[model samples]
Target: MISIRRFPIRIALCFLVSFPLWGCASIAQWAAPEKKATTSAPVEFVNAEQEFWTHFHAGHYDRIPQLLETYKRLYVLHPDHPVIAARIGFLHVWHLSERMRMGEPKASVIDDATLCRKFFGEASQLDPKDPRFKGFYAACIMAEADIHQREADTRKGYYLMKDAISDWPEFNLFTGGYVMSQLPWEGSLFDEALEWQWKTLDLCAQTKVDRKQPEYPAYATQDFSGAKRACGNSAIAPHNFEGFFLNMGDMLVKKGEVPVAKKIYSFARLSPSYQQWPYRNMLEDRIRKAEENLPYFRIQKREEISSKNPHLMFHSEAACMACHRTND
Candidate 1:
């Protein structure tokens, strides 16, 4: 779509942006078993899991403390189990992330990043080679950077993304790690952001999720690939890649590249992942919104350049639109 260089700087955007296994549970299961096939959980796990699911599904969020304690005890019992540790980490990452994003008081009860490090970190340590844990551990760092604005966390996250993206062969985890690494911070303009988003979008389009399960289901110990499975079906990043495409198209529109942005936005319709926010309307409304604003961005970019840096000229709207005209 629109090139980052031509995209006019815009106001900082704030965008609002899993599972389990345990000891005896290998993170990866190599068997090509049918995804819909159900595996049974032990009585202890089933009972505890039922309670966790009861509150989890009932929307009893205040029960988070209780759930954390329950998972903590499970972790203690399965000290070597990265599965439990990852589950604990997922709880903090998924549940706490929303709370933290809203700046809630209950969110303050624990340091989100610290807990991420504690549980996901433990899982990574226990299974040092697993890409899921490694990538997610890096994700925790990014979360820390987003919430607390920590420089060290950002650097660490960047490094982790590089490593995880390179190391993981899977489509989902690495794409997620890539997006997490590339997402822009307040007032930050990086050339690679758009490219990363494009790649993340492609990954989302290509991924195929077989089963859709509710939250806090009692997942068995062994992972599909054989490593410790964390967060049940929630482990792989959401295939919809909402944050990736949202920022990508918005950035393009801001720069007066509505034509290219429109093409990019079209990919959303092809995606099978769970849709949220702008995607609720099939992204048609968002595309229309961007197109309507195209002229404004073009004029605004020219004006901004003329006033801010008189030495250089801005691309005309005609020139920008010409870049995306169909060849046929």
Candidate 2:
């Protein structure tokens, strides 16, 4: 809920919402249902190459080592294949993200981000014309911002993320991610964050995806996995980013804008994509917490009652009942 009550501190112009987590949705639609993945490929090469995705999505990283080798061999064999190059790059970032998820030390996270940046750099080079590759490359670089890089370099990466947004405004992942990065540096990004989040909601609301072009050689028909199926059929359903709402609510809460935070949390809880996130189940609880936290609830005491040796208590009737919907 956008509010009319303005604050002396940063409000519309400057707001940064921080809830840390790895970006999860595919560059395009992520789910592939028609092709059920098996541990063993009936065809050795196809099975070997796509085996990674099963383990990847199924949360089985132990198999990732073998999958990495298989992708390496495939990339070498097919040097011109953009998907192979991109997958290799994607894996490097994924490996680093998973490490961070496990509470890996900051030093280790920084080290992995270093490798991840290099991999995405190679991916962008491998597919120089695709904005997707360039965007992913920039996103990977952003991981190291303020964590492993100097302030100037982090600022440079921030501008690069802005460039990525310019390159593809239709892509909400980069837009929302860029907004996240900007909130800390620029309070003006508050308006921009709202603008982008609303646009993202529209993008997520759309039923169709416009991948536009597909490379036949880019796909391994034998195994529907990785970058291919993630974007193959434009008909594949789009994923919602309830996380974007979560992030916005977090920003509002940090600013003590409970009204707006409540609205955002409410909207987020209603999203189908909310169910997919780890915090989805917790959203309503957060909303109630925000409701309870709003200012000027009833306070009652009889200690100073008309000098009658009773306690004194006062409650802001309007404020107390403002957030309460129950009859009681």
Candidate 3:
């Protein structure tokens, strides 16, 4: 029961003609009715869906398996509900592929790539052209690329990412394309990666503008929040605040911004979220060395010091002799 709007040409023309004079007043009146209607109805959902969202927001990753099982039971009772199917499929990717939480000890679970493939495949089959399904399917392909990389099948990974980019152009698929193009191929991959990065950046900029348009889908709005956080807002400063700073700092170090990079890397070392990341220790060591060498590299120049002392002797030996002469 999605709402669709249609206006006859005559009505549209009249509305357009009157819009300048009456638009604000009409919008105010329309808003009251909408607000009343929204407030009159109680928000309700299937008990399992409610439970799933509750656990999700609570960060109960360890309990996701049990919650998912309950969702499966509800699904059996309501096989025709595409929304529920989509939710379950999306959660499988969030927990399995994204590893939104750490895995449990001794729990033999299916790898993320396989779980993502199965769920997204089923979801897309159930509801073709559902943008949510397409987005999740793209995610599954990207997860598979990661799995392929781990298994040393770089060619398979690259192709999978390329297919994902082609299939889900709206969901930052160019990022996947960029990653695929950057696979360690004896430095031949740089140009390909740069091409994809440029394409991705351009697409993201266009998508950002489109999302601000009034007619964009609600799902797009939701997905765009995370994407915007990742790419758009400079105030949030992703590398400085998130777990990304460590890697970014390392890149800066390699680019020769030693002092500023070390400061950033030092902050990353102290971030609790990044404690388990592989680069934590390396960043810490780099910070220590940078701090230890700060005095030598950052000391005031001898010329500047000498300029402040107009009558001081130029040579070290002469200066020592002048101080030690003791009014002789």
Candidate 4:
């Protein structure tokens, strides 16, 4: 893997940069009593997603298998439920991420990727109106491309992502941009991804974005109409604002804009949920080592960075913790 500094600095490269409750069902309805070992427990399909976030936020990896089985059962019961399919797809990605982080066999990763693609693709087809499903569908395709080393899959994923962006320009920009962030930081794709980040900010604030100044403080103070759950302090995704900035700031740091990156990093503090974020230290640490951290990050291939690194937003296990934790 080449260092980002050594990679070409094209003009375009300079140009740019969760979760919710299970459903309307009551929490009591979602909770199931412990059953005897011989007896099968009742599944809470309406709030299965809520249970997932509970386990995920608590770092209860051991509980995921049972929850996954529950989701699979729910999917069987509700094959038409796009949300269930999408969530199962997400958990499959998480399952594969754990494998990758642990250096599990390639066969396991391939299987997980295949399953991830299947469910997310199903979700996208079931509800084409939802851009999130479409974006993740494309993400799973790209995941397969990387795992299988297939250029045709890459092209297909890229086109699907483009269509997703066009369909819901606001949120999919972040989604598509995030999937692209794993690419070598020097490429045109990476540059376009940064530009997409800028576009996302403009939409988030509903104003022209100026990179040099601190806009987050104002973003925090002002109330805007139609702010999506993805952009706000959500119970299901408490650290979305924080994670978004961490990602954007990391991109800026890679581009040799450490000072500007520091500004970007501060945006994490704008979230009201920041104090409760278990990964808050990662942001502070990044701010303190903005320039010094560059060499350490540069030595690793972008895709090969371990998810265990708490600071690396996209790949980190903390990515789940960051976005989904309800509290410390």
Candidate 5:
């Protein structure tokens, strides 16, 4: 029944040189396993949330599949845990974000969208007070709409995003604005998104800070303690401040306000995370050639660029990985 003739040259040589003796020795070792080097203690089970955050902050996106399995297994034991559900939901979206950046086929997104919608919707229900859960659920709905070409779901998702923004202006303003940013830049919806970014910056600055200044490097030094978690820099989202300005500047550039856009882009440099941010060169280049890069920033002409290029806010790691990964 065995077919040694089909084996590779290396395997044939091994068989010819050391077959019977090696096989006999392997069988003997397999049957005789009485010796013990030492006794080991069982690993202590850590808090699920703590473990998730540990891996997340370490930029372990590649381990997401394993992480998902671990969470799902734990979810069965703690069915009421909103944090667990939200983590599951976020991971699904994170995976979807990766697939999108890689230019994976649209058909591959359905499973991720479905699971994302389910867990986030569940998280929103379980923790009704946390608007972030609801916001993510609404975003998942919008994603499903795009996947399935459902117009009614589109309207429902938009209205839900609007409501979420009203409920928590500082956090949802950025989140909801990000969802709206996918629209064509020429539309009123895009303008509203741009307005939301201004509102976000205003809220982020608890004290009166000049928005018209040519440089606001003080943003890097300001106190973000009182600001909402999404509004400030943290281990969870190390580059949110910088990413926000990068997005705001690109919006201004698309609207043909090159000088204003350059100033807005400068805000990104003010963030302490700028040096660690892998996309710092992209922002620097945009600031230096704001006028020349205007056409490239517009939504209409993005098709001309490669799908793999991280050119815009939504398309770039700024949307997700910049918050999770140390390197792209």
Candidate 6:
């Protein structure tokens, strides 16, 4: 038995050595000669399209001009691509509008606007019925008119915004509609401005209603209560409604409708949709101010009497508190 085990151990050692040698020979025979390492080529500018949004989100607006130029050059190489055309239009509009808002030099603003108009024009030419193309085109026109500050330009802007509203009623028209409504008033086109504002409010209401629907486009939806319905399926979306509600609250406050304005402001502050936005801070600030001033305004008559009778002593310290309860 000892001899048998010793013999098997010796055989196993021999087989392991032979197996490795055989395997190494086979591997050597199968192996090819190594070549020089090949370097990866740089990505084309068109492929860098997604990076543009990354930069934008990082607040690297200064890089946008060069990025846009690169994108433009790339698009020129692929002019027939519908997606390229749409991207060109969108980038042009967004960058130009943002630049204009930043109060860039008039010439630079104009050049950017011209580029936007051109791209949008091309996008529209590519697909006239594409809602995104039309909406973006109209937005570009309206934004350009706004930056130029031309009264006639504002009229054009208003019409363009109206077109967007008519064409894409499901989309949030907040910026375009707000600007259109305000511009006419600034330009002394009160009647037109009022009409625009009312129209905007109506659209806002409809958008809100649509947002509640389960089938709402994703892109058309904003953070307002109406978004879930408005954005049934799209990807482009709006900011929260805090800013819009604040604007409405301010308007109502100016109109001496404090209670209603307060209610709107309070809603804006409390709404989960708006809790993350900078405008939420603004809403909170406004709410505090309103709360502080509301008591005085509510007792305007008493304040007047107090001012007139400054020397008169009150019968009780709680006299003012009686009318100005914290509940109010």
TM-score of each: 0.52, 0.54, 0.42, 0.78, 0.75, 0.53
| Candidate 3 lDDT over residue span 1-328, tens digit each | 3234544666778888888669788788877732110112113335666776555544455666787677666566555556656666756655553231242212233465566666666666666555446555654665565545454444544564555556555333433432332133224453364345335434544543221121212222222344444322222222222233333333333334566556545544333334334334444655666544333322234333222221111111121111111111
- The full ranking of all candidates by TM-score, starting with the best, is 4, 5, 2, 6, 1, 3
Candidate 2's residue-wise lDDT over 1-328, tens digit each?
4445656344534543221112233422455333221223234456754565555544454455677687778766665556666767766655554442343223454665665566666666655666666776666666666465466765665576567666655553433353353243235655565546445444444332212221122121223234322221121222223444545454555445677666766655443334454444445655766645332111112121122221101111111111111111
lDDT (C-alpha) at residue 222 in model 6: 44
Per-residue lDDT of 143-179 in model 5, one digit per residue for the tens?
Answer: 8887788999988988998888887888888877777
Return the candidate ranking by lDDT, descending: 4, 5, 1, 6, 2, 3
Model 2 regions lying over 4 Å from their true place: 1-49, 61-66, 76-79, 98-100, 104-106, 172-195, 202-239, 272-279, 289-328
Top model by TM-score, which number? 4
Give me the overall lDDT of model 4: 0.73
Deviation (Å) of 308 in candidate 4 = 8.0
User: Per-residue CA lDDT of candidate 6, range 186-302, in tens?
Assistant: 334433433343344455545332211212133233444443333221122223334445544444443345676666566444334444443355456656676454333223232
- Per candidate, the number of residue pairs that clash is 19, 12, 0, 1, 0, 18
Better of 5 and 6 by lDDT: 5
> Candidate 1 — which residues are off by over 4 angstroms?
1-43, 46-66, 100-110, 145-149, 169-189, 201-257, 271-279, 282-285, 291-328
Q: Of the pair 1 and 2, which is ahead by lDDT? A: 1
Cα RMSD (Å) per model? 20.3, 21.5, 24.5, 16.8, 17.5, 28.1
